[model samples]
Target: MALLNFSQPLISDETIAAMADTMRTGWIASGPRVLEFEQALSDTFGGRPTRTLTSATGAMEVALLACDIGLGDEVITSTQSFFSTMNMIVKVGARPVFVDCDLISRAIDLNQVEAAITSRTKAIVPTHFPGALGDMDALYALAQRHGLRVIEDAALVQGSEWKGRPIGSFGDIATFSFHPNKNMTTIEGGAVVVQDEATARRIEVLRFHGIERLEDGTRDVVVASGKYNMSDVSAAIGLAQLRQLPAFLAQRRQLADRYFEKFPQIEGALLPPRGVAGQSWNMFCVLLPFASLGMTRQAFRAALRERGIATGLSYEPSHLSTLGRSLGYREQQFPNAERIGEQTVTIPLHCGMTIEDVDRVCDAIGEVIGSKKH
Candidate 1:
């Protein structure tokens, strides 16, 4: 049997044709295709000042620059998501303040966010873990109260929404990834969406190495700020991907429904997520009961591999890592994150999965953790 991939991008002939068009245009570096992609994103996601970049990491770096977040600033992010998030904070010369996640939804704990905010806190980088934004409204309110810039690291959130708002729709700034494993792929692209015009303009310039431009129907003015802009080829791919996104999300949600239903009776061993309809279902991650999975996360993953299934630990508690230690953060700094880090498992989930595929995975998981119950 062919191994089910953790995720896959839906790139049909349309995507291929788009790439061909970009190549034919011959201005494939950073041109109309990029603008087309960005406009498509803004229209689809409903955010102003949306600009595409090379990757989410690239977008994040530019967002920090726009915020003037550097040199001793504290940017709060969770430990349960991707490591690149915390690394991006550190890359901007700022200290990444770690926050534990709420045990229920596995998103960052709001109270911890409130506590982590000091005078140095410049931004709150909340993640919608698996596209479920737990207590996101509360998080936004907290950011507003503290006058902190909210930059949702929405890499895993495409269709995700909170209280009718897309995760990227209302943030001060939001960065999203377009890697192959993501709900969509730009052949590798991302973007920074900002609510404010000036910040948005800053990101636009920053993405292209600080070159400011004025389009008077012909002539363009250049400026002294910009770096890391998206290429026209990538933009072309993104345009095609955006058009296919609705169907892509629908398929992922369909599979998510199956997984939730298939494993509902498993009790505490397999807790499913509950949220509104727009969820991206980016990663079908789950937490096994401490009882059933007697072995640690690594051991369970090894067993899954032995059964020809692949698994992964999305991330670890950032506060307990070497960099966190160097920053003087101890394990106690974020106990919830530390625990979730040790237990979270990223199972195979993608738009390409079938009902039978879900069933097979569910069966394998049941076998591994059920009969081996501690």
Candidate 2:
């Protein structure tokens, strides 16, 4: 059997051409191209202000800083994350308090979040898990009622929508990633979109060493911002990807459909559920029936790799990690988060895959889950 890699980027001739254009301009870093890319994203996001960054982690840090959240302050985030969310909170001198995921939905439970909040709570980051909003309206409403900032870690949701609004459009502050593995790619990049102009300026300044310079060949215009500006090359690639995003999302949805249709019931393997909720389908993950499977999530992943397929877990639960421990988050602090982190398997889903590719991967999953049965 020919081995098909789990996931790959969808860069095309246009992406190369954009890179070539950036090379031809001789202004590779923070040039006109980045501005153009930002404008395109803003327009795509219903005119919301989106500032490109080196990575979503940086975006998250800057957004939190802009909101004036820091030491003695606490930010609420769920256990499902790439660790960067909690890390960012710590980076800004703030503490990260974790809550559990809704067992069936895998979204953060609103009640737990409400219970975690105290006077020191400054922000709430509701991560858009696997492309679904995770009850965004309620989270937003909660933040509004509490007067806390909301910076959504929507790294997995590029074209995902919430409550008829684009996920990036309505939050108090939002961040997203353009890593090669995400729904779209600028190779490795991110953006911070703010709800107000003043806050947006604060982010721009904080990202680029606080010394902002306009990319105009003019020598006198400086914006005194952080080193957060995107390179023209990266921006060009981002624009190219943006143009292909809608189509990419459609293809992902198609692949997910195949997974849903051909899914075989394995006692230990649980299919992701979709009710009125929709996923950005960023990653297709499933929980293993641990009791029957007799393998940890890591063991299961290694087992799949032996079959020449790639699989991974999106993250380790924040409250259970070393960094979390140093910050005083004990294992018992977030039992549900600890459990989800141990079991979730983030299988690959990217545009460079064919339906046959998806089936091959899906069959491999069934085979693994059925092995114990046999």
Candidate 3:
């Protein structure tokens, strides 16, 4: 039996050929293909101002810079999210205020978010976690009430939607990741979609060393910025990936539904919430009742490894990390997020997975849990 990967990119030969064409063009640096990719993203997401960047982290940092969220300002975000979401806030010379996530969806709790806002709160960075969509309507309404900017960390939700609108289409700003394990791959790339032209222009300048080119080819130096442009090679791959995104999302949904159906056979395992209308289902994660299994998450993973199965933790809460501790975050500060961090396990879910593969993984999970139960 082969060791099933947690996730894999579904790169087709067409995408490879596109990359080859880009390499042959001799203009593989950030050029026409990059612009094309950005335009495609904008077109797909309701004509938003989208800019491709080297990574989602770069998109996030540039978004913060564009919003002028610096020094003395506090950016509220979920403690359950990937560290980069919080780290970027710190990188932009701002403080990241942690909010707990809801137990069912594992998305940031909007009520907690509203409560966390202070006079210094400049922005809200909500993460659309794996297999779920955060409450965008409520979050946006609260942001409006508090007059805060919203930079959605939509790294896991490229093709996701909310209330009949695409995730990036109507937000103040949203960033996407195209890492290989994501729903799509650009080899390694990301983009920021902004609602306004000014913010879009700021990101363009900030992504490429702060050099703003004038109509007559003159250059204006804005604030000091980093080189974070996506190369044409990557954008070529992205264009190809974009063409296949709908198919990729469909396959992921199929696999996730299979997992949802089979996981219930294993007692004490908690499946993801159902009826989530517009989720991207980037990762199919489940929470194990560790006490019932009489095993730690690591022990269960080791058992699965013995069966030629692999598992992953969706995330360990960012608030419990060394940096979080340095920033005065302690354990149990956000109990729901802490519970999710300790209990959640991400199973194999990707465009490449079939129903049989899903069944094999579920069977392996049942065996592991059954053995421990006996």
Candidate 4:
């Protein structure tokens, strides 16, 4: 039996062909294909100004630069997300003020976010947990009232919507990832959607090493920045992937449904939220009762591997990392995130997965944890 990998990207033949075409054109660097992909994404986000970048990390950093959020400014964000969310804030010389995630949804707690905000708070960076969104209405209202810029960490929620509005469509600034394991793939790329053309133009310069074009066709570097441009090769793949995103999301949702239905009713094993239809269903994560099962997460994963299955940890609590420690974060600072980080496992749920695949994973999990229950 083939190992059911935790996550996989669906790269169709057409996507490969598009990549080949871009390579043959010899304009594989950031060029027309990148422009096309950016335009397509802009249209997808309700005509917001969009720019493609090398990664979502770059997008977030650039967004911070565009918003002038650096030097003693505090950026409020979740402690439950990938380290890049906090790292970007620090990269721009800003302070990252973290709030613990909600136990159920894994989104940042809005009340804590409000409490974390102080006089130095310049922006709010909220990450939507895989396929699930926090209270956007409340989040934005709070940000608006505080005159804070909101940069959504939308890495895993490309097709997700909030109350019928697309995630990036009306947000202040939203960054998306096209990493291979995401709902869509550009092999490796990301995009930023902004409210206006000026921010978009600034990002263009920021992404391409801060080189502003002069009238005589010469480029001048007004600010120090690194190159974070997306090549046409990646963009070609992204354009093809974007075209199939809806179908991909539908498949993911179906797989998620199967996981929910087939998952065993083990006591203390917390299931993820049964997200709404608007959710993009990026990956299915479950928090297992490892201590009760008499196994560590490592041992449980080893058992899954022995059963020809693969499992992954979506994240480790950023606040407990070495970097987080250097910044004065300590153990138990964010209990929910620390708990979820230790116990959460990402199971297979991808466009390439079949309903039977979900059943196989569910069965393996049942065997591994269910039978081991105290």
Measured over all alpha carbons after superposition, the RMSD of each candidate to the real structure, in angstroms, is 3.0, 2.8, 1.3, 1.1
Q: Per-residue lDDT for 84-203 in model 3, tens only?
A: 998999999999999898886888889898889899999999888756687778888899999999999989888888887888999699999999989888878899999888888888
lDDT ranking from best candidate downward: 4, 3, 2, 1
Global Cα lDDT for candidate 4: 0.90
Order of candidate numbers by TM-score, starting with the best: 4, 3, 2, 1
lDDT of 1 by residue, 11-43 (tens): 889999989988998798988888888888998
Candidate 1: stretches off by over 4 Å: 212-226, 264-270, 290-292, 371-374
- Model 2: residue 175 alpha-carbon error in angstroms: 0.5
The 0-to-1 C-alpha lDDT of every candidate, in the order given, reads 0.78, 0.80, 0.88, 0.90
Better of 1 and 3 by lDDT: 3
TM agreement with the true structure for every prediction: 0.91, 0.93, 0.97, 0.98
Instruction: List the pairs of residues colliding in candidate 1.
Output: 205-226, 206-227, 207-227, 207-229, 209-226, 209-227, 210-225, 210-226, 212-223, 214-221
Model 1: per-residue Cα lDDT at residue 18? 89
Clashes of 1: 10
Model 4 spans > 4 angstroms off: none
- Per-residue lDDT tens digits for candidate 4, residues 163-205, read 9888999969999998988889898788999999999999999
